[model samples]
Target: MTTGLLIVQILNGLQFGILLFLVAAGLTLVFGVMDFINLAHGVQYMLGAYLAVTFVGLTGSFVLGLVLALAAALVFGLALEFLVFRHLYERDHLDQVLATFGLILLLNQGVKMIWGAAPLSVPLPAFLTGNVALMDGILYPTYRFALIGSGLAVGALLWFIVEKTRTGMLLRAGASNAPMVSALGVDIRKLFMIVFAFGTMLAGFAGAMAAPILSVEPGMGDTVLILAFVVIVIGGIGSIRGAFVAALIVGLVDTLGRSFMNDLLRLFMSAPSARATGAALSSMLIYLLMAVVLFVRPEGLLPARGRT
Candidate 1:
């Protein structure tokens, strides 16, 4: 690839990583602090995209639609927490998985019924509709640059909140030892609700942001959800810092692998065979990385500070 092409791919990988971080950040917290296995979290992402489409159609403004959709996503997530998730906190893992899996089916079907089984699109705002020159001859999409900036800003804000605030301290404490935190007079239940609701908003934000670039369809969140799981596993389940670092690693590895694997393989094998083999290996690269990580550092590269 040329230098410009390589630069574009690197930026793409960074943008992809940022989105994954947004989704995985909330998921890791919910799993780590609350000890809840929420398989339906991806549905929250799907709901965000759907809600954005609906609201944007009604308002005719991308910004307004995003705000409204995020709010709606938050409320919907809180409702799920109150109605379904709150009750499952102390249940067996099998039960949690089954219940949330049912939720995935219900919501996915519900979206299809309401929006039909077709993919949807969200238009870019006028101000962000074109590309900007990054170098003498290199240009990149304005909206994508904005997406990267936004994700980074949010990541920084999250880091500040988790690393420097009282709520964050409690969150860390809860993740390390919920019973002890409760014994110290913290309202553990309320904290958990806050975490879940916030995480829901983050996932929704990721979905809404991605709607313009990717197909906004019923099952779009499924693939992203699986990737988010991979991110957490590689980052260490409870560590935001780990999630951020690992997300970028996975994104760069996946994107770069796909872009160059065939070319690299062709250097040593027949073109046709190289293409086929490269495709297979590229897809498996991230999983192979995960297996290697688990074998080498089972607790993950940057495990949560207080986790055993």
Candidate 2:
């Protein structure tokens, strides 16, 4: 690949990694601290995009739409926690999976009914519509740079909150031993609510930011949900640092593999065979990476401190 193309691909990979981190960060916290399974977290992301479309359309302002979408997502997530998830917390994981999966089906259909089956797009704000030159001949989308920058900023903020704040200390303690944290006089349930709400907002913000780049449509969050799961597993279930690092790795491997596998294969095989082999191998690259990581470090690359 040419230098410019390679640079662009790297940026694309970084952008994708940032998006994955946003979803996975919240997911890891809920899974790690609350020990709860939320298969419908992806639905929160989808809802964010859908909400952004609705609000932005009404107001013609991207920033306002994003804020409103985040608020709505937080409220809706709390509602789900109250109406559905709280009951499942003490139940078996099988029940959590079944309940959340059903919610996914319900919400997917709900979106179709409300927004129609067709895909929707969000118009970028004027400041975000153009491209910036990385070099004399290379350019990248301004919005993507903003996405990467914002994700990094969020990552830093998340690190601060999780590493420095009282809530974070409680979250870490809960992840290590929930019953102990509860016995220590912390309202564990309230903490759960806060964690779940924060996670919902993060996932929603990722969706709202991504709406301009990806098609806003029904069931769009399913693939992202899967990727987020992979991210948590690789990063260690409860570790924010692990999630950030693993997300960037997974994003780079997946993006770079898809972009250049065929060309790389052509150096050793015939064109048609290379194309077939490249496509197959590229699709498996992330999973293979996951398998390798699990094999080497069962707890993952950077498991949380108390995970053992």
What TM-score does each of the candidates earn? 0.98, 0.99
Compose the digit string of candidate 2's lDDT tens values, residues 92-150. 99999999999999999999999999999999977798999999979899999999999
Question: What does candidate 1's lDDT look like per residue over 1-308, in tens digits?
Answer: 78998999999999999999999999999999999888888888889999998998899999999999999999999999999999999999999999999999999999999999999999987789999998888999999999999999999999998889999999999999999999999999999998999899999999999888888899887888888889999999989999999999999999999999999999999999999999999999999999999899999989999897
Candidate 2 regions exceeding 4 Å error are none
Clashing pairs in 2: none
The whole-model lDDT of each prediction reads 0.93, 0.95
Whole-model lDDT for model 1 versus the true structure?
0.93
Q: Which residue ranges in model 1 land beyond 4 Å of their true spot?
A: none
TM-score of 2: 0.99
Give the range of the ten consecutive residues with the poorest summed lDDT in model 2.
65-74
Which model scores highest in lDDT?
2
Q: Give the C-alpha lDDT of model 2.
A: 0.95
Cα shift from native, residue 212, model 1 (Å): 0.7
Error of 2 at 228 (Å): 0.6
